[model samples]
Target chain A: MPLPRRLVLTAALAFPALARARDTIPPEARPVPARLLPVPGTVSPELQRLIAAPYPVGWNVTPTDAAGWRQVQVASSAAIEPHMAALAASLRVRVEPSSIAGVPVFIVTPETLPAANRDRLLLHLHGGGYVLYPGLVGVGEAMLMASHGGFSCVSVDYRMPPDHPFPAALNDAIAVWRALTAERDPRRMAIFGSSAGGGLTLATLLRARQDDLPFPAAIAPGTPWCDLTDAGDSLRANAYVDNVLVAPTGWLGGAARLYAAERDLADPLISPIFGDFTGFPPAILTSGTRDLLLSDTVRAHRKLRRAGVTAALQVFEGQSHAQFISPGVPETAEAFGEIAGFLGRHLA
Target chain B: MPLPRRLVLTAALAFPALARARDTIPPEARPVPARLLPVPGTVSPELQRLIAAPYPVGWNVTPTDAAGWRQVQVASSAAIEPHMAALAASLRVRVEPSSIAGVPVFIVTPETLPAANRDRLLLHLHGGGYVLYPGLVGVGEAMLMASHGGFSCVSVDYRMPPDHPFPAALNDAIAVWRALTAERDPRRMAIFGSSAGGGLTLATLLRARQDDLPFPAAIAPGTPWCDLTDAGDSLRANAYVDNVLVAPTGWLGGAARLYAAERDLADPLISPIFGDFTGFPPAILTSGTRDLLLSDTVRAHRKLRRAGVTAALQVFEGQSHAQFISPGVPETAEAFGEIAGFLGRHLA
Candidate 1:
């Protein structure tokens, strides 16, 4: 008889883990190139630090992190509160938890809001590879949008994998969105996220529309992992070079499997890159050359543009996936500023 | 009988010239990715003016500027004196012509040299795709190094193609290196260049060591065009994305042919990537992500490191080839500052 699916996967992965080098080699530390040097005055030390920052090889290993991610998820939600408090220095925003139609979310609001955007709201989703960021780690991006964007923000602390997987997160997001639309004009709201949250932001929209809810005014899915299937060029081309999402077929892929289980990975609600974006709100996405999902971001932007949706792609230099989280990281600052500016054009 | 070599090359190149779009794309405005959006603080209005600074497309077409490059070369050498005068405002350094052991060179000394590095000198070479940068344009990098690095610089207006090509530029660089080493102890000097100058810097060392001359303390080949043959991945991957050298198969490639002529393309002198870098001095190379020659810089740095040479590769974000010339470009400022710091480590 054919082996069971999980057993087959475990057996296949066991060989690689046993055979592959136990140590990891950072991309920056990876030796050497062709060609002439570039024009002078272009290579800055900041870009150098951003690109050449070294980490242990296999830093993005899925299986290695799978247990940790699940453990964090299983760990008391209160443990992440301090991590959320630490994010205050970078964002300078007020954060407090509240129920959105019974869905728990943190409301993030800047000290002051612009006169034009005083009434507008930003809905944010946090990235954690669909398996991590159990609590306020999920609100890091929301804080950025709230503080940098000068708007009231709501970060969905939606249900997640292991205990709550697949459509649970989607159901929570749609419910919160429905509750949001009940009290506020959808056109005055902008939704955004990065990484897994980025993919969920898009998935939420597909579900929101299916539930007959209206779209938000704009979206900034910063480096969205839109394709759960990992079909983008950078997934392979940038493999080890992008230290964050090291390889397409590794733990991150396995995490997707754990969340997706019986769900078709290609479902428009799962991988939004394959969705029809016609009539969707204008989008502004972000990525970097070293982002393993760079192709996902680029292809999604292209897909949106091809469908006649207004889309803008903002890519940073030398950054890996969700590099925006690094405190005082210049690229992250730029990402937030541009997203806000883009929102200024479309939102209230 | 085979047609005369020149006639055959002309026939082969003419068809593509007559076929291409003929629209030169200013590096920033290339159609591949659009909008005037730049990194927020980094992309100031002035720098924006400098980079997104548009120009006639098809400027890289050889036929369009063949006359211009040659005419500038053929014009009275005195014409460059005025250009040098123009640069004095930017560099605040004295510029004048001098001969060292019968080899002509331009000396660039700063307003004041740092006491720690007062005795040190930087031998410089300018990049012109092995064809252009006929005059003071050759010393732009030298001026930056002088003004920012605080080291007296000697820029080799090395012989280039269409008039002087191949071994001519290499010979000139080597002669200058020898003449300089005779005056300044090689230990207190560093050699540097970008593009063709970058490649020539490497070739100069090869030639100098072959002739038993001592090596400089270190070398900085910024975005050096180390390979004449198009074997690197970036030449194809970044073809149109890098507006400076739009396609390796076009005028840039044609220019290499013009320089190489009958020279074996794979000779270590022509493509230094194939050369043995064992016992080479420590190197610091620069390139940008969008630079078509990025692979070249990465490969060379790796080769040198593998050969036990200390090699540091610095790359910038969003920049095309040679973006350092644009005034007030923050990346340029950082490049010069870091090079000066790198020089301070080894030069004195």
Candidate 2:
């Protein structure tokens, strides 16, 4: 079945949720020729290779329930489990399984912490479209930040659906945040993540405001899935052009539905793009030309700036949905560098 | 002939300037299927209709010389000329032919100017790939701004290539800006345009700085063709996806070549993306998800922000190059509204 238009106006509309008419799509939506793309010379050789590479394994799986999601999660976790030790050793970071406020987490500490960031701490949220990555497999981004940005990190292992949906993940995030803020100075802390993790980063802030919690010094939300209602221009414009998340209809659409469950997709908690960003701390957003969530990140940046918060946005040459985090791509290093630089300037 | 890779590293390198190997194109480039695109529900009915409409007349023309370009320019100018009076009358703006510093211009004034902007003025530069819109026909955007933004505007009818090239347009822009500042406060002035006009807006600022002139309070450079070298990622990534400009191999590449003539493409004056943006005034940029110049506009906003200048970027849903300027589209009004609001806050 084709992906249905998800932005329903009301509950009583009885819109055809599963029906997609042939003439409904925009006529301008046509195939893009690869040769017509920016030549290989535009981006670094490493990114060029990655851009030309095939999509990651199992990018199109549409798991139905918790059992099915767990099965896919285990396979993905095991695939990265072997490389975790080597990756940590190379970065000279120590990763220990831990828990914060009873929420499972990973404590990542660099071997030689720079004096400048000694009092600073980063709360990391791993992104897997709110599902895929679990346990140690999700600590890669945290490890990268610890190693490259010279900061101690806590990687949030938030709960996901089809068992724990909506507020469960948000609940775990706020719980950890509350615990961290109670112990550490909010002025010396920051939060960062990519994709679903990025979405949670913003939602956490919205929740923090409601709880009257002091906000962190800054944030880095890279290509956030902040609008889960699938209401951004790139959701349609970048469909197949974005090789990684080739189309919203694939796994992503299923994941959003599975995760949101019965909750309103436009609820600010589920989609932070709809949340008020007033008085939010300085933010640095990252995305690529071909990312499926480019519009989400751009909208979040605009919202932050509109609310009078200082915000910076960096868009890499030609990347698709978190491709900046690809193993050793130069774009990955640059993306992290820009985020770290922004956070460093804001953190006390 | 196909658009050659325009970003040549050096003049002495004996590269195959005219040859393009079929294998050189990325294998991923294939014809996009319209059915897989975002459904028609994403944008306004007016914009959807425009998006669904066929490309504008003469969109694919590639004139060879001065005479050829002149013929094309006349046809385009004549086509738009018939509507100028009606558009101005409906917009409630008076258009008067005038000259500043001996350079031809169209002075646009809203009949009911808001008291706040009585002394403020906007310098307009119209876009036509640097060779299309000329004379009174180029004042459409100025009229829109005068009527909608409630500000007096001076639309620079700058000279274009095939007759005048390189610094001629930039020269005229700076001359008018200097003349305007001589009599009025620079703090109350803003400059704007789309496409080539957008490019000229940035270039004008760079030139003004060199002449040790006071800067305007703000600027709106929408979908600027800021990089004549064709160095941006969108020039390739948005190739066929951008319906209006289709591909870099089209008339745009030819126009860039004709305008730049013998100058270095990467010279900061020619490509403001390479210019320093330090101390630049607040700027609000506009582009669409599918604009061929989206990357250029994105890059300029980053540059301005990095230099500590406030910048806002609005990427409309499903817009192509300058489609935000399409008459009667809600997106166009929104795009102009964002720019006008941003400028209003900054201007004295």
Candidate 3:
């Protein structure tokens, strides 16, 4: 195998020849920048450390501490809130200062107020594999909620894993709910998230039931990681084809492990896939075919239906994971429209 | 377990409310029909008998050949000249006629195309569950191919199944290659199909590899029934979520069995996922998340990528089988555009 110098030369020659034959612009010839600059935001020291840490690989280095994890979690969250705030400002929406059960919160409301507004609320959870939190990701959706569905949105900056593993984020989510229900009408609120946030949204519902809290009117989990066990066929099926995230063993599965370190991967409270969904609020699930978590969404929908809860599942063909976050893409707009319409029908 | 009166009344009230909530405006509310009406075409007596026969609950039966199952071996083919006559009248472009082992072939190029004009051919195979020759469905995709890709296409009215089961469609696809190579080139073709045709698009590539024909530039097997053995998880996963075609033992799986008959379900030729794809072309596969064959598309992409073929799988976020054929939906346009871009990169 090592002695094929002529063959190697032939292969090298073929690369350019093939490119010419295909008439493709070489990567170097493309005009766009090779790197996407990180959005401007204040980086908290804890967040800086978390982001700088090499993502865990294989099944080692399981850090289990709620306090340590919370520092990284909050710092990372604090770093990105300004970008989200900036995006909200660009959308001309005002972010109202608020507190949910003593947890500092921001409510994004549209510039043009609609009178006689029904008390519909969209509680959004940002996704970062349960480790990183990018608050800027949901501006488009939040704006869509305000303008299209006529609902105010409260995005939770929940605690993260490792330091806040297992039930910490779930507890924070519930705390927000406990506080929101004290003032907002329970029948008019909805929970929504993408990726880990999506998982948290489902887990929140399970926790709400266990804690005897008021249930939101509806829930929309977009490409949720409902099963932390990596039991979904897509985990094996879509390992490489999905390009948005790192490989599973290093990224998604790693994050899930850190998030569920002390908890059983199949625990309903941690994963939600194993939860009893009998009395859960109506749900609207969205995912794409190419999404690695497509099976999670599908299985969750099936579980909800089997449990006799009304669930609507909408899949976008040829889409990657969290495609709904791609602001200008038609699928994103269409997905948001569908979510708003669904929330309007159920919560309003 | 006779229902109590109170339970029955409760159920009665719940049923109508559920039905009303589930029911969107009927297809009639829209200008176009929800399902494509079969275009009127001349049918042979044998085909008429087959069409008139009741389809079994779990079987996909079509009026193709009256003869029982038999292996079809292709020895030669006749050329069908590019019919400029039809193109002029229909605002289509007639590609030159060529032959695969002397099988006459023609390509119908679309006019007033959508976006790109280079390096993409929606290599459509007409459906009759591998039994009937391509007809109405061929025309359907042709219209879409022309309007969507803004490129030329060739519809392989491949030979049917049972009388010409496994290899005939494959042979026709090869003939399409022979024809294209004889006239144009192989670097600008993308295979596409629906139902049985979708299965053939997949199966054809498996055959193309065996025959050493140039692989298609790319492939889009829409709602393909790749698991002829009915082994995919979606057979049960999408049983009720899918509305257009019945599931599990319905039209798709039944057609697969009838066409495949006693063939090994894992035979890669019958089910491309089983085939070794060392040299297959890049592909863009599509399916509705709700389609029973959604897993088929997922499995194919996974396998293709595992074998190192570049693949982009697109699942329409929320749709039934072959939703792209519906036309005018933003999803259809998006899917077609992605396929075009993929083809352009690979085929150009």
Candidate 4:
């Protein structure tokens, strides 16, 4: 056949695929590379919507004092409690408030035990940038564990920054653990959490070992903020690219500073990544590619491997900063399901 | 009540939580961080086994010269065709050889006719650093589109280095498009590929525009080898952390050099990221944090948007080069399905 003519369709439609004809497409026609677009025909319409769902921009207005921080916590808790209740109810779990050694806690228990592992327990810590969520919003991870792992769960209502700060949350966790261990077999239990809760989970283990408390059967720290110091590579490499936690120097940095106050950030309790991890119980870690803590999680996994601990990491695609919390997202179920499955095999 | 001991069992657990004897747990007993552990009592005995499943390490003994590269291609093609055949049968797609304008291609068509839109086509380019994965091995990406997207697919079995380097692949794609566009509506067609295929898919769009051909409706370039010059950040940031394509300075770099021959890598046809995306069709990009070309893919998406193209990005966690191609991965299905969905809406 004779060579087909060039420039026919491009010239006809004036499609801007031509760089040499830069003037063809106007500047305003260009849109910001929005994080995720709801493109049709690629995935199911429902998934397209889900993938394109925007994360609430969590811009922290640094609270100057305890009262201001308390106000922030109250407002956040009120908005999230209802959602947590709905999630728990859907998972067929009951939420009841109680006190352990005078510290308030939320108890999450399945309505009916599976007749086999009724005595097993999981302690959960919720993630909210260390100062955001309190009370019920802090129980999402606990609810998942109780609902899916066939174990009763409890979450500590830990004191947070701008008020109690560093040692407070850690102390609260220690107290609750001390109370639980009074009767519960540590070997039959597991502790897990996400975000700040994830960091707290690692710190709790360190403190527990320091106090000579028995180790839990296993732990799942979902994208643990192990290095509160922002020493991870992704902190710079993924800045702005990770729409969530856009910059560690902003809210994430603020939260870390507020929590640490006069304390050393490198303190193992604050940044567990620097802590001693040998002989630690088997651990499972989870995180997303866009999560600013991607390096933190990966580094933690690497450290765990170095320490010869049995660790399993389950990372989901297109996720950011605990995107697993959305009950509607399949990745959420996949993450929690994997955690439950890992816990099932590891828990005493 | 009396000041209770620090270690007490929860009334529910009835097991002891101990503290106070800090000396019992020696400091030396605790090591550094750990990795995925088989935590007892967490998951079923079976799932723990599944979660711990090891990836078959893909070790490539890359050939040094043109003839060696050709031999490697034959060996790899022979090894992978049976697997691809099994996958095609499962997807109910018939894969057979066809020629368009003297270019050899693989036609992958769904067995059943959908009531609507059966005339639409997806042109797939397969990936293998430029000189590898010839013949059926190059058709993996095409298979995914045909199976999941319900589209009649055709993969360009483009020429590679050692025999037909550089513009051979791009030219072959252009020739095929020219022939196909003679009979088919350009807007009814879409193109995609991964790695080298991803790069070629992009170059095809650039060259097609240069030839002034009508634009395809959409394209999905998965973890594209956009910058053949190794300019992207992840190439360094990810380094050995990415087990696949471990170091670009090694085989990946070698392949790029061979493919380009004497051409400038900055040439839009070689590294399409440098191309002006002014009027390109709406596009979707996919990659993972662990993929060394992650920056390449991300940067390309950014450029397309800056050039005024409608583009979407989906990043996976803990994945390597085109890790989404695993036949058993739900993420693979999810990724391909989304691409098909996007094309469906954009295609005529």
Candidate 5:
């Protein structure tokens, strides 16, 4: 009746069939699926592509000067607002346009909220390997995060790789931060992101420190791609077990090369694990055991702690990378709840 | 019917009486009842005195001599085996004596277990604040970890602090590890500890790296005091909120100083957060949000990650430090389950 026992019984029954199937397929070809992966009914095609990509290579390869890159970035940005508008309508949150460092930004606040009911502002960067899935694609996830976490969220559509490259995304994040400091109190702020966005979150903090900018009260980098080099053992060891990513050589590693094109891979600005983390704020990082970037999250967490930064790392079992975006999953919801509690403790 | 909701309602009803009792006691005079402390029933007289004393003043306080430290360590070692023996008796596991680097070690193996069964081993260190509660006091916990994890646990009765200070505990752990390398394979091994033992877990890895020893598959540092300087903000911020360890200044801080004695507090062996973590294994660090050393766990996790180490951190809500010893508590059981699950994944 229970899951594990049921699984055991079912596995016993299917052992012979599984063995036959294994014999028919070559080990090297076993990991690749033959059919078109079905998108969850609730997810958009754009998001599906973003999530389904072997690695976020497309984002890194879009040429900065190319017309196609410009069109894709524009299309991506345009695609996001409609999704967010739908989410805002459902959640009853007031979504307003604002400028941070002259860049257009959207501030989503709970409607009719009073000063006593003030919540922390989360500056979020959406994950798409820095090339795709702008703020719009994250509307559902953002709404879920805000409602569950009881915070206002501002999702940024930073410049993507290929065109903008290493510092472009980092620069945009800092500009928006400076704008927030000019208009809002830094004490009421936290930063969060997943995948490439997660890496960007850490990069932003490092940039803020170097530029003498105010740090957010807390940060959450979920399955961050902190090391562009993909030198961690998991990148090799977990290559097949993790179903989401294609493989480091084919996807993530390629994306890294494109993102870091002419930049140094060890530049702390590009790979925050190498940054001087002297004055960063408190942070919480989440990852899964099967994630290729699990090592990156661990490395970043240790670096921050060594620098006297308050930080926590949470790793979920039996999960793939950035599974947090799939809010319908039990693990995703629990992970969000943990983030909410961590933020409440620090931000309160 | 649901337990959490019922408990919340019950707590709400009892709030007024609790407030009244709090008002009757002065803030400084408020004493946490013994029942709320970890392993309250087992607090020895010497441990009480050590915990109650104000910070030792001036240098050359004639710290515990080598013989005195060894005597206390041995006594504490003897104290823990009874509980372990009781657990092994209940689980029908065979307890055997073994020597590791001339130090006596206890191994708990499940009875009638097949040779083909997974060969998982937990190398556990006991908590004592580096001063008290050595090997003997931790048998119950060690046994529980071993049983629940479905593995043979080799618990080391490593030397304590004061007389044995700094590298002494670290060295002893490495020696046990060396002995283990000859006895077992590294692929299915894990290291775990609590409090001072937790610190030793991290310290051991540092020593192992410097000495070119094989790394364990995974590690669990439960409420580890990773920072010898006691400089984490939580020491001051959560001082009163934390029910265990009456005062950080006299309790943990003083204990750390006395344990390290004349050794440099910043030495990587003394404070693992300062170590180069390039060659270490994956780790899982646990703590309660209310624990004074919660920040230490967080910081240590971050440092390990930044050095490209795979690490996971889990913080239990509403828990005191090292609550893992209290297996009756649901949170404790859940924490152990998580540790076991993590170990299973990495070790399998």
Candidate 6:
């Protein structure tokens, strides 16, 4: 069961998360602030409330093995079930289970789609650190975007670990993308997602570029997990400052390992930040001052811009990871508005 | 010598540095690390050396009054004189003292200016928290840009505080801008600066927009102090973390008061972030992860983009305020290269 010497070195390089120093930890060891801080009055009351909330107790929970991951996934699906009906009803978005190229997806349609966006379709990749939020649970963000952006969506319920890992989710995403782009005019389509979904979105484009497939009109990868390895500064600087992903060594790192499996984490599809962004579509990235992936999102935007692609980035005042997905918040509305507007400009 | 009630209220609003909470202070209260951290190996050795250096001993030194500020100015000039000669010599840039429309300026020309940039000129405004670097001392950055960017620069030696405050600096910048634009095609010109100089650059554009004058083709405002008021989140979030401007209540706030005099800090002419960015030229902004003015730079970029202007923003990893200006650093080269490329794209 022992790994070969070369494999060990590659594994070491792949999971540098273990080798990362605790330098991001504030030398003065004070407890993380429990209050809305740095700048409180500047943000909305709703955001203030959201910012003050502590990290979920089990945020860093790690499953012992494949079976444990399945249990966590099932539990997550169940927990998210109750909110599904309510969110769909309030947002006036209908989520229909569907399949594209044999890949499971949730076709999210706004009750009142704008005539302007009638021909527009957004490919959605739902976020859950590549392990959680499978099935209908992953459709929440897609639903929100559909409702707010007034565009129909195909939310990929991509395969995840415990059952299928590494190329499974990306394969599902590519399959859906390939199927959709085949029938639809790629100019009228865009790919969008948050966190892992965001990572998948970029990976999809990188694959499309590699396959010489026509690129989507645009992309919105919100606080993407662009780099799987512990390569970014914010991973440390925003460590405990980001309440959502409290630290890099927590569940996120474990999820990354579970997802990558035996593959090298630096593989472009695994960590798209290492991928070349040349000839990629215009992108609008979102993160927050307090987001753990702020560095990932900004770095990706910089890379894209450096590649001569127009990339717009918006960092919310006090938001943590994917806090813009919180419904009824002004910041959420603004974030979605920016994304929708940016996508609209590029899409036919 | 008691101030009037109205003045006191305005002063309170103008200088909220005292009222700011210490929420950004890491709860653990660990001493700031002396080593390069968070992501040590990510940056160049030059940047690592620069970032690890502690804040200048008198970075927060507050002059008691007009005479004290004058004394500080003289000291700053003397100290900077040595670097001026060395930098100019090394950069292969010729700095000539000149006057534009009665305003003192430094015409920084490269030893070998590229033929393509013969007609292109960059109007530079030097950064010194609006109270330091005066006369020829303010032209070092201009020299770097001239040599590295292959563009001639006219660095405005704008009037400063104690004797000439508030409108005087803005007036000098505007006067020079008007005089230059009157002769040169506005399309061939760009305005660029860092920190307080950046604030002035934005204010000048806002003024031009107000007066129905033409705007420069492009701008590069590096880590601008866009808001004179304590309105930004980074002012608190990056407090002691930004070694350059360690805290909001230091000499920065004092300088703000000295610059504004009796003016409201929220005035668009003072805090240009408060100004409308409609019809502005393309802009490129730069900042650092650890910059106190990071929020300022990002906020300005957002505002400009929101106003339908083409704005590109580049934030360096693990850097403090204006560290991009450090000569012989890869980051410095990268930052200037981005600005130069962006400006070239916009300029004739």
Fnat scores for every prediction: 0.00, 0.13, 0.01, 0.00, 0.02, 0.06
Interface alpha-carbon RMSD, every candidate: 28.9, 15.6, 25.0, 21.9, 26.2, 18.6
As for lDDT, the candidate ahead, 4 or 5, is 4
Ranked candidates, highest lDDT first: 6, 2, 4, 1, 5, 3
Tens-digit lDDT track of model 1 for B1-348: 111111111000001111111114211211112212222122234333322322213334443345544643333222333445655676688877887666678899898888988888889888767776555656767877888778889887777767676888888888888877887799999999887778888888788778999999999998778888876556644554454555675556767787887888878887787787888888887776556677677667756755767666555544556655443455566667667777788875
Docking class of 1: incorrect
Q: In terms of TM-score, which candidate is strongest?
A: 6
- lDDT of candidate 4 over B221-252, digit per residue (tens): 98889888767656644544344565555556
- The per-model lDDT (C-alpha) reads 0.65, 0.76, 0.56, 0.67, 0.59, 0.77
Per-residue alpha-carbon lDDT of model 6 for A136-186, expressed as tens digits? Answer: 777878877887888899999898997899899999998988898899999
Q: Which candidate order results from sorting by TM-score in descending order?
A: 6, 2, 4, 1, 3, 5
lDDT (Cα, 0-100) at A240 in candidate 6: 59
Off by over 4 Å in 1: A1-348, B1-45, B55-60, B64-84
Using DockQ as the yardstick, the better of models 1 and 4 is 4
Q: Ten-residue segment with the worst summed lDDT in candidate 2 chain B?
A: B9-18
Model 4 interface DockQ: 0.03
What lDDT score goes with residue A270 in model 6? 95
Model 1: per-residue lDDT, tens digit, A292-348?
Answer: 776677667756755767776555544567665554445455568768988988986
lDDT of 3 at B44: 26
User: Model 2 over residues B43-103: C-alpha lDDT tens digits?
Assistant: 7786775555444444556777778777777766655666678778877999999999999
Question: In model 6, what is chain B's TM-score?
Answer: 0.88
lDDT of 3 by residue, A1-348 (tens): 112111111010001111122223222111111221121111222222221222122112223445534444444344334455555665567776666786655687878766645456788776767776533433345555565556678877676656667777888888998888888888888998888878899989888888888899999988888888866645433333333442355345657878787678989877888888899899888876546677688768767765767776666544446655543334455667677777777875
By DockQ thresholds, what CAPRI class is model 2? Answer: incorrect
Instruction: Give the best candidate by DockQ.
Output: 2
Q: Could you give me the TM-score of model 3 versus the true structure? A: 0.47
| Model 6, residue pairs in steric clash | A27-B30, A28-B28, A28-B29, A28-B30, A29-B28, A29-B30, A30-B27, A30-B28, A30-B29
lDDT of residue A74 for candidate 6: 66
RMSD of 4: 19.4
The DockQ values of the predictions, listed in order, are: 0.02, 0.15, 0.02, 0.03, 0.02, 0.09
